[model samples]
Target: MIGLDPWSPQAPDDPGLTALLEDARAAAGDPVAALALADRATERLPLPGTGRTAELWRGLAELAAVDLTVARTLEPHLDAVAILAQAADAGYAVPPASGTWGVYAAEGPGARLEARPGDEGRLVLSGRKPWCSLAEHVDSALVTAWVDDERRILVAVDLSHPGVELVDEPWVARGLPRVRSTGLRLTDVPGVPVGDPGWYLTRPGFAWGGLGVAACWLGGAMGLTRRMRTAATEREPDQIGLSLLGKADMALTAAAAVLTEASSAVDAGLVEGEHAWPRCVRVRSVVHDACETVLTAAAHALGPGPLTGEEEHAARVADLQLYLRQHKAERDAALVGQAVADGMPVAWA
Candidate 1:
């Protein structure tokens, strides 16, 4: 609510933040500018579900309107704020703030964090964390590691410490290349336990945070969809072209409506109930499917010229494809399906 647009030309808290936003807005392939923007976003990160749900969603949309890669890259750090808040609410002692934080709990084969507790509440984290976004750039991160054979614990790590290495080799995806997401190899990295065992994934806000990601995907898709709409209006289009445009418009409009409605529901404290996770899943699936349709229709309507020739449009499409992979699509849809099968009302207002 502070700024109407995330990428507007309004004065930021500082001149450096303004420059950072401008450079990030211009960054299509330049990862450095995007990194600077990521750093600036750290200063005033909001703790999610603290009644800023709608504002965070809108900010993601505005950022997506500029560069989806930058938006995707910065979103995890924002998610970290929410995760930290959840841990604190769960009665876990988070590490003292040094700088911005990220949530990197995604694991791959042979990935596990070993937590060795030291005297005076210090802990050393070692092992491989396979999927960390903004691993190298972020100052700290809330990492997940095996506390026991049965459960995982959340550790707040100072990424600037010695023996913390970011392995970019595994992050070979070109779609979100500017995001700098990679594997973290920690060799006795110092940290502090954030939450009790199994708090990170079990928290209610986890799914709600996932919805925030879907919001970004929706925003990116709408940005790309608008290009097709603009093209359809600018040129004298045939019926087929107009038909594709219409389809794209419908998908984008419906998705936006769902997002707005969800925002209102969130503001009304509707997401605090037992069905919150399922509801979040439903919203995410809707927006995700809508975004896929928008991307397809935009490509078919605008043709390959915008994709291969235009700089910004192509990047948006590519970034969206990569960003949407954050969630298990089919499985997410199946959750909603199962909920409906269990006689759970969707409250489809």
Candidate 2:
């Protein structure tokens, strides 16, 4: 496995980092190694500054011909946030604020950024984004906004523009805190358009993005399952033991299978257009159930240790439990019901 610690302060060229990246890239060419590398890299890096890190992991996962939508969603948002953080650390201006969907807005008053025609006959942006991720470190960013009465556009803009305002309130969360998901307010910051209007969320890429979040949750469940095994072994023979171990193992296996199947469906582009909402609802349902099962088993197995201890494992368990609240059982059920009402097929091949 690649040994570079992504959280290290050393430059990207550091020998360890280099080796890790090289190994990851090479493994991308293989099936088993690629999956291993993806799993390991996520475990190691967790929050990477460049989208490339997540992309690499995404690519590795893709090698299995698996659907990667859930993984993709989590990465781009985190990566975008990471870029803003890196930009700030490098002395670039960044906006202050928080929230995943609230990053786009005219939060403050300044030279408003807008896209205009460039010398190459391409759309150019002339606006600033407030509260952007890694805004301090990134001299520019890729932003999406309304261009006219009925058009929206995504563009790359320079953060250093006089019209930009970057508020620097850092984002705080129990998991993936390294993402620096700040907020941004835009002024007329110069930018270049990436694709046509509304393409960002409507494309195959966006579908995969949502799937990525499901994958992250799956990973967390996997982590909990591992912890459960360790805790089970540490249990006294008479204490809550083998039953818990078996339950956790079974839950993990089932969850992993569901995730793999859903990922495969997404990778094959079978989860789009008419099937989009149904597929999403189904995956969300599976993930919600998986999380519940694994977490329950872990809690039962670990007993009061997780609740009372200050150890890293305990903290991880707590975090996972807290996050599961966001994927409410009720909400998922509603989605499934809606999918059925709409007659969208939920089965994946």
Candidate 3:
């Protein structure tokens, strides 16, 4: 595995997290085992936008490099914690600590979840929540449900509640197959309001959390880049192999720079208000593009030998490709371009 970048301030020395990541790498094939490892990793992660935001992102990147699905399973758990933290800081109701958590805020075309007033002023959720990854595994989740047509509220729900139901949908994806993302069917499930309507998406931590996912993409790319580097070194030194290595290195370097700068900005409390969305869009786009470049370079350098013969390499390629799609590509770029067009400061200097 590629070690943390020593030059980055985001890279901190944590022996405990290091050992956990090593264990996670060893258990990459077993999703259940890896998720257990991720649960243990929760305490090790620092809340983003805090003083140790760099370390927080570094931990996420390292986890992703180990296994994208493992990272995927764990990231939402961390994000849920961050959201709860934000809510707590804002004097909102917070749920009792659970074993593991997930953030299930994805909406789809089917039935939608709604929060209704319950006994003793509590909220109860009912309806279907889609795109809930590890819904069967996590102990709880911070879910988003419609309070009305114009308002959606974030609520913390216990996954093991009697009213919660997991749909047995067949997940046939080749990449990250271990972490199945299915839908949840709720029947008046008890829930605690996390934040007010629109707070989940509007918070500064939301942007910080988005950047955390970008860090994972960067790590997955680094994993592929390492395979390319090893392939180039193991065999005869051809100009083509060297060129690919150079390409991967250059792309990763640029990605790391943007990630580091953005991470520092987050830690400094600079990612807030009107600037958060644009800044996050820029960092995510840059890192996503860099990951794409690295993937291409690695494929060219290592050829079909590793792709066919290596299980890990093939899995990483597929996993990275799927995970990077979370960035939304040109659709997100259009938002950034619009921001630039609207005269947001472009500090290239």
**Which segments of candidate 1 are over 4 A away from where they belong?**
1-23, 38-46, 89-91, 96-98, 272-274
Whole-model Cα lDDT of every candidate shown, in order: 0.73, 0.50, 0.83
Best by lDDT: 3
Candidate 3 regions exceeding 4 Å error are 1-12
lDDT of 1 by residue, 133-197 (tens): 76766788888888778788888888888889987665567687667668889998887887777
Candidate 3 has which clashing residue pairs, if any? none
- How many residue pairs clash (N, CA or C atoms closer than 3 angstroms) in each of the candidate models, in the order given? 0, 62, 0
Q: Cα lDDT for residue 301, model 1?
A: 84
Q: How many clashes show up in model 2?
A: 62
Q: After superposition, how far is residue 287 of candidate 1 from its true place, in Å?
A: 0.7
* Model 2: worst 10 consecutive residues (lDDT sum): 1-10
Q: Score residue 97 of candidate 3 by CA lDDT.
A: 55
- RMSD to native for every prediction? 3.7, 10.8, 2.4
Worst 10 residues of 1 by lDDT: 1-10
